[model samples]
Target: MTAARRAGGPILVGLPAWVYLPAALGGLFVITPLLAILLRIDWANFVPLITSESSRAALIL
Candidate 1:
């Protein structure tokens, strides 16, 4: 028992496939909106658009 304690543990725990399934689904749920906004952005003008006065005011509000 002392040797096992020094070695870290006697019992090992593992995540189930069901746990991974929910985690994957939750990740997709959270990422979808971010991906949508990324897709809608104009990459070439992104910096200018984000820094414009109107955009800044909207964000501040």
Candidate 2:
């Protein structure tokens, strides 16, 4: 047996490739839309946009 596998020694295990793929894709899935919204933000209209009637009504609720 390998030294790592011997009694009281540290044992190591390998993870499957498939495990990481979903996690990576999920991270991208969540971040992509938020990034898109941030990218589309109009700095010039930032204040007026958020202060509009609809925006105020939405915030009040």
Candidate 3:
């Protein structure tokens, strides 16, 4: 096919490229909470909630 025909297929060229920044920031907004939970976690409580072998299982994952 010709260039014009390909352009009609997806039409990604000369599009609103600024959407990438907001899309990436939106993804970060979703993941930031999970990161905070991992960071401020109480490691000491794992001994009761997770035994030695269970803790090893968690690590293996």
Candidate 4:
């Protein structure tokens, strides 16, 4: 085992600068759809709609 492992200290690894752009794009790609869905929600009736019997049934299914 290495000295760091033997001492139970955390090991850090450096990543290449080119790796960040693709990582950021992938994160934005996942988050954009969720943000769009949230924007489309009818906030005025959100509570009642979510608490209705049909909504409960659909969630249960």
RMSD values, in order shown: 5.0, 4.2, 7.3, 4.9
The candidates, ranked best first by lDDT, are: 4, 2, 1, 3
TM for every model, in the order presented, reads 0.68, 0.61, 0.47, 0.77
The candidate 4 region of ten consecutive residues with least summed lDDT is: 1-10
TM-score of 4: 0.77
Compose the digit string of candidate 4's lDDT tens values, residues 1-21.
223333566774567778889
Q: Write candidate 2's Cα lDDT for 4-58 as tens digits.
A: 4657777866677688899999999999999999999998999999999999999
Q: Candidate 1 lDDT (Cα, whole model)?
A: 0.84
Q: Per-residue alpha-carbon lDDT of model 3 for 14-37, expressed as tens digits?
A: 535787799899999999999999
Backbone clashes (count) for model 4: 0
Q: In model 4, state the lDDT of residue 32.
A: 100
TM-score of decoy 2: 0.61
Clashing pairs in 2: none
User: Would you list the C-alpha lDDT of every candidate in the order shown?
Assistant: 0.84, 0.88, 0.75, 0.88
Summed over model 3, clashes come to 0
